[model samples]
Target: MIPNVLTIAGTDPTGGAGIQADLKAFSANGAYGMSVVTAVVAQNTRGVGSIVAMEPEFVAEQIAAVFEDVRVDAVKIGMVANADIADAIRQSLDTYAQCPVVLDPVMVAKSGDHLMQQDDVEAIRERLVPRATLITPNLPEASVLLDRDVEMSSLEEMHASLEELRALGSQWVLLKGGHLGGEESIDILTGHETVELTAPRVDTINDHGTGCTLSAAIAALLPRHGYIDAVRQAKKYLTAALRHADELDVGAGHGPVHHFHALWNNAPLQLQGAQR
Candidate 1:
């Protein structure tokens, strides 16, 4: 059966990130996607201008509604915005702890706008991180979680930072090295073991929704396959998505990666089934 994945995140009106990006990534990666919006942001490739957070109870209701009807195999979480929403998500997931949860610790947007509050980081670290199956954090987000400056100058420093993050509670930690200046981007997956996956950095400035897309892709692939295989496949999918990032121009600034690139190219057929 096809896996069903749910995303608990904010709404990106531009459809480049948050729940919109998660759904697109999930669909592209062959999983049925569902969403529970925790907040809504007025945003685009330019930047985020305003945000409207959903009440904690309302967020809980949305999650309950989805879980009541769908058999979610995995979940990807993004931009909770505040502590109340984070707490609500933590509580809701506690009851469904068996599901594989991928936490994309999104603190700031690619356009340099804060997506999560600084005060709420501790709540996320304390309440949510321990429960996640995997936590995907870029260098800056990892720094915030680990309370140290992540040195991008060397791979050893990066590996050490990832190990420190792994001690925080996640069963697995995929520390993204995209922020490190280089021709190639290396993402290290460290948990039971460390695996280094690298992709030549696409020369495009459009990487707005890459994090959301990556985590969503991983969530979609994990249940239908297995964790290690899913990570390998998801990396390839993300690299292809990034390569096609320049095809479409959605906004004036950093735009989204093309999540449907494979489908557009008529890729090899897999199990053509629907998740219910």
Candidate 2:
């Protein structure tokens, strides 16, 4: 059976990040995608301009509505704009705690714009981190979560942070080392065992939604794959997406990775009025 994976996140009209990217990654990973919007964000490949967060009550209602009818096999959470919404998600998700949850602690955008407030960080750590089956945090996010002034830059540093991150209550923590300067990107997964997932870094400017895509891919794969296997497969998918990212001509600034790179083999789009 196809896994029913749900994404609880903000909107990215550009289809590169947030809920749009989550849905695309879910489909590419062979899962049925569902979504509950938390914020309406005005963003593109360039950057986020503005955001309007949904009421906490409405956010809970949306989650309740999906759970009351559908079988949510897994969930990927991203960009909860504030503390209240995070609280609402934490509470709303309690009833269905059995489903696997992948939490991407999205604090900043690719453009270096802050997507969440400083205080909101605490709320996520307190409410969501403990509830997550796996928490995927890039280097900078890990620093913020640990309240470190500088980001962890070396493999030793990443390994050191793993125990501290796991102490926050997550069953597993995948610390992404993409920010490290190297030809290979290494992500350390710690929980049942320590595993290093290494992929040749795809050098490209179009990595706008890489974090969102990775976590969503993991969530979509978790129902069928084991913990370490899911992380490995998700890393493989994201690497291919990044490698093919340049094939797309989306926008001026940092663009998005190709979520459907494996399936969409450069077929020309059919124009409405063009001759065949």
Candidate 3:
């Protein structure tokens, strides 16, 4: 059977992040995708203009409907706008506790728009983080989650931040270091053990939905493979997706990575280390 992955997030009209990006990543990684919309945003590659949050009850119903009919292998969650929506998502995951979940604690958009309310951050911390199998956080999100500044000055600091985030109940933490100023980007995976994956930083302003894509790819790979194996696959997949960043023209500003690069080119996904 095809692995089914579900994404609970807001809708991005420009298809860079949110549900759109999750679905794209799932498909690119050989998983079938579904979505439960929490909010609808008038956004593009440039920025978000406005947002309309759906009722908590409606979001619950959408998740229930998918769960009732589909054998969802994993879930990727992003962009829960308010506490009510976050609570609803938490309840749904509680209802189906066996599914592996990948949480991308998306606090702010690449355009610097606030995707979540300040008060809801605690709700996500207290209720959602513990339930997630893996939490993917960049340096800024890591700072917010740990309630301390994460200095990205060195690889050692990045590993320290990953360890701090792992203490926050996630079975694993993929601390992304793309925000750090460097010629190479390093993402450290900390859980049962620590492993670092590095890639040459493609200096492009077109990286819009990178975090969303990474987390979703990891979620899609988890059920079929072990945690460490899936993380290795996800890192390899994301590196190629980043390398092929120049192939798309989805929007006037900050286009998404070329998720379909493998399908078009038929290149093998390469991993830097052993697959678990």
Candidate 4:
């Protein structure tokens, strides 16, 4: 059966990140996609220009509506702008606690813009992180969660932080080391056991939606595969998407990964000028 994966996230009009990326990742990974919008963000490959948050009550209502109808096999949570929204999501998710939840802990955009409120970090760490089946946080995000002034810089530090992050309440923790400069990108997963996943880093400028896509991919695969296997497959998927990202021209800044890279045999057809 095709798993029904739900992504509770903000929007990216450019379709490179946020809810758009999540849906694409879900479909790419052979899962039926569903969404609950938490914010409407005006952003592109360049950066986040603005974000308009949804009311906490309405966010709760959307979750309720989905749970009433859909059999969500797994869920990917991203970009809750404030504490109220986090609380709302936590309360709603309390009812349907069976499915695997992958929380990306998206605090800052790839463009260096902050997507969340400074005060909201506490809520995510305290309320949402504990509830997630797995929490994927990069070095910067992990540092923020641990209230550290500096990011983890080495493999030793990453290993240390993985244990610390697992203590933050999630059953599993994936600490991404893509921020570190190296020939290979490494991630540490700790839960039933600790293992390091390493992939040859692809050199690319178009990596806009990597985090969202990865977490979504994991959620899509979790219903069928175990946690460690799902993460390995998701990592492979994201790496391929990144490898093929340069084939498309989407924006001036960081472009989106080619989510359908493995499936598309032909390049996109460009249209000539015509009457609108």
Per-candidate local distance difference test: 0.87, 0.94, 0.86, 0.94
| True-structure Cα RMSD, model 3 | 6.6
User: Residue-wise lDDT of candidate 1 within 121-205, one digit each (tens)?
Assistant: 9988988899899999988888888876644566777886776788899999998888886998888998888899888888888
Model 4: worst 10 consecutive residues (lDDT sum): 265-274
Residues 161-221, model 3: lDDT tens digits: 6656877798988888888868988888888888887878887778898888899999989
Prediction 4 TM-score vs. true: 0.96
Q: How well does candidate 3 match the true structure in TM-score terms?
A: 0.92
Query: Between which residue pairs do clashes occur in model 3?
Result: none
Best by TM-score: 2
Query: Stretches of candidate 4 above 4 Å error?
Result: 266-276
Q: Candidate 2, after superposition: displacement of residue 186 in Å? A: 0.6
Q: Give each model a TM-score.
A: 0.93, 0.97, 0.92, 0.96
Tens digits of per-residue lDDT for model 4, 1-276 = 889999999999999999999999999999999999999999999999999999999999999998899898999999999999999999999986579999999999999999998899999999999999999999999999999999999999999777778888999999999999799999999999999999999999999989999999999999999999999999999999999999889999999999999788465544586456
How good is model 1 by TM-score? Answer: 0.93
